[model samples]
Target: MKIAMVCLLSCCAAALCISRFAIPEAAAKGSHSHSLGYRCPMHPAVLQDGEGTCPICGMKLVPVTASGPASDGSLAVTPDQQKTLGIAVARVERAASSRMLRLPGRVTPDETRVYRINAGVEGSFRDVAAVTTGSHVRKDQVLGSYYAPAAVNTIQLFLLNTAGYDRAAKKKSEGSLDGENVDLISSNLQQRLIQFENLGVSKRQRNEMQRTRRIPDTIEVVSPVDGFVLARNASPGFKFERGMELFRIADLRRVWVTADVFPQDAPYVRAGMPALVVAPEESSTLSGRVAEALPQFDSQSRTLKLRIEVDNPGFVLRPDMFVDVQLSAELPEALTVPTDAIADTGLRRTVFVETAPGLFAPRNVETGFRNGDRVAIVRGLSQGERIATSGVFFLDSETRMKAPASGATASLTSSPDPTGRRTSGGGAGPFQKSSGDMQAEEAAAHTSAAALR
Candidate 1:
């Protein structure tokens, strides 16, 4: 009787333990078997019970399905979520086009064509003829004349020496002098004549002095070249020493257009490239070609100097005139994207690539020469890949908010419950919920409990 009673009590205890634990296990199994849902990371309000993305933010939502084998399958985002995320896409196309680099420059004078005239001798301020800066003069044109006592004395002495030489020559030729005297006199006169000729006494003047028996004291200075007088330093009566600069003349047929290019861009510019020069005060445009590239760089501006040669038949281009120069070079065809597509973060350059509808992944890219509105993609991308051209800023912000591995894990979590807390339910896992949603949920729950009570 004691054994039977003990066995019956043990069986009852066993039954009670099984009932207590088995009920909860069965309930948990049923709960885990239910399908899970997900919500968009960008738009927490959007919820999906299937495998898909959030319709609001276009981000894949966390799956409500349990993780275990018994748990419902993971949620797959529907196409509707893709449309909500404002996902933009572009198709890559291969096209042949040349990239152009433009650089700013200025107009200058050709060094070879410019000349400066200086006073050969001193004496001036008697009169002024070529007074203005831009006045044109010709070769041998008398710019002005001056009277110097030293010059006058030199001319008179030259005339006197010539007269003595002519008389001595006449006497010798007429055979009126002895052989020794003739030889000596002839040699002496020849030396004096050569000296006078070396002093710039023209042959015509010498002949006229011999014929008219007179010599002019005043000296007339003539221009050497046919060009516009760029500068004037001599006055009618102003006395100047030898070799002093009196005028400057330049040939305007050819001019130089100098441009300053950034050191980084200097490599692309070379001789023989086409350039356009536009004066600040004129509407006309001048065309020229790059003649040379200076080896030195401007320390102050950190720019390379480029010289271009142009024709100035109209004499419109002037020295010291500010001008605008356009230099262009052709680049080979390359893969390019809109400039706005790149997000420069100082350390790295990033771009958002749309892997799917409303689904973007941030990718680091290397960029190259940038044209006006487009930039060349040197690395990190292939042709035909969809890239965000416009609205990239917004996409970048959204991408930053998600975790680095969010693209893979976003569809597996649940939306957060009210009060920013995640509920232990089988619906979309609590996504990051805004304060407004939390407040609304709290108010609704409070009203529901009050009504039930």
Candidate 2:
């Protein structure tokens, strides 16, 4: 009888102590913090004007009081996690911000400088011993020769005219070809010589043909620009028509650095923007300006074309050579933070703001000018706030995994999906099935054996 009585008295005493002291202290804490109502200390999302237990974890309500401005989605990190995740923080401040853009590009021939060498006249190719693909050619150097009927006729006519002119001049001591002192034969001879020169017959060659009185059948097609032979189409004895492409020449003294830019960044790129291009194998850097942004984009690469005109003084940059390009721009004054702080998704940008010691919360933000490691904050943040700069990605992922889902209401109803599939735990979980269902599906065949038996 005495043991039962003692046990009952002890239990009553313990209950009274908890109710009068511990509960009041917790209530006072909640009241002092919020100054209006009570809230759960562990889950601040649960708020009430009166004291109550947390709905998520059933923890006792603590008093909510003024703790300063902070994001509601703030989460606390333990010391171990901070070390493991390499979390780093910096204070947000106003400073001069500049934007430096880095782009990967390649050295390409300037469209205007890539000269397509075509046969000047129609004839068969001759003495093409030195002409070959990848040949370095000088200005006015013959690549190869080709035979064309009209070209042969012009050269032969030029030789005949010049030879006839010389003989006429010899006879012109007696007067003109028409036997007049006015000498209209000189004018006619000059016209014939100009026509022959229009056929790309050099003065020296014409002179040689005239002196030898030879009716040249084949003429040499020469390069107008000093460059490397990009392509060769002519071969000895091959009959090619006039205006046919015989060689493709490109001057490497200057080239174009075509940078591939994403469409989102296309607005800042414009003509005359200063740029620098550096090749991986080359020692010196080439400076240039944005010539133009090609209207068409590469279908497979889906990148906007930005052309930079670069001077290759020593022939250091070659066509198709990969290069790194940097473009810098200035921006208006604005609040900024480290670029590493921003968490980027395709549709939205977020940052982890340090609310309290070891507590970081995600805040949706708009970003502006980006320069190196710094990014301008257009919205959702203020100066004098602290933000997690490095390791924000890991912190964001950890917060989603560890923090309780806010505004989660309990629902037992099996929500139907678009396909009429029953989705438990309401329709807002994810766009996909839970892991439990996936596991059960994977194990369903093993359970079927019991039904068969």
lDDT of 1 by residue, 10-111 (tens): 433332222222222444465635544554333444444465533222233443333321111111223443343343468644444544545566655677
lDDT of 2 by residue, 344-438 (tens): 87788889888888888888999886766788898999999998888776655544422322222112112222333222222212235455644
> Positional deviation of 181 in candidate 1, in angstroms?
19
TM-scores for all candidates?
0.59, 0.60
Tell me the lDDT of model 1 at 396. 52
Number of clashes in model 1? 36
Off by over 4 Å in 1: 1-86, 91-104, 148-215, 293-296, 354-359, 382-386, 404-453
> CA lDDT, every prediction?
0.59, 0.65
Q: Which ten residues in a row have the lowest lDDT in candidate 1?
A: 68-77
For model 2, the local distance difference test gives 0.65
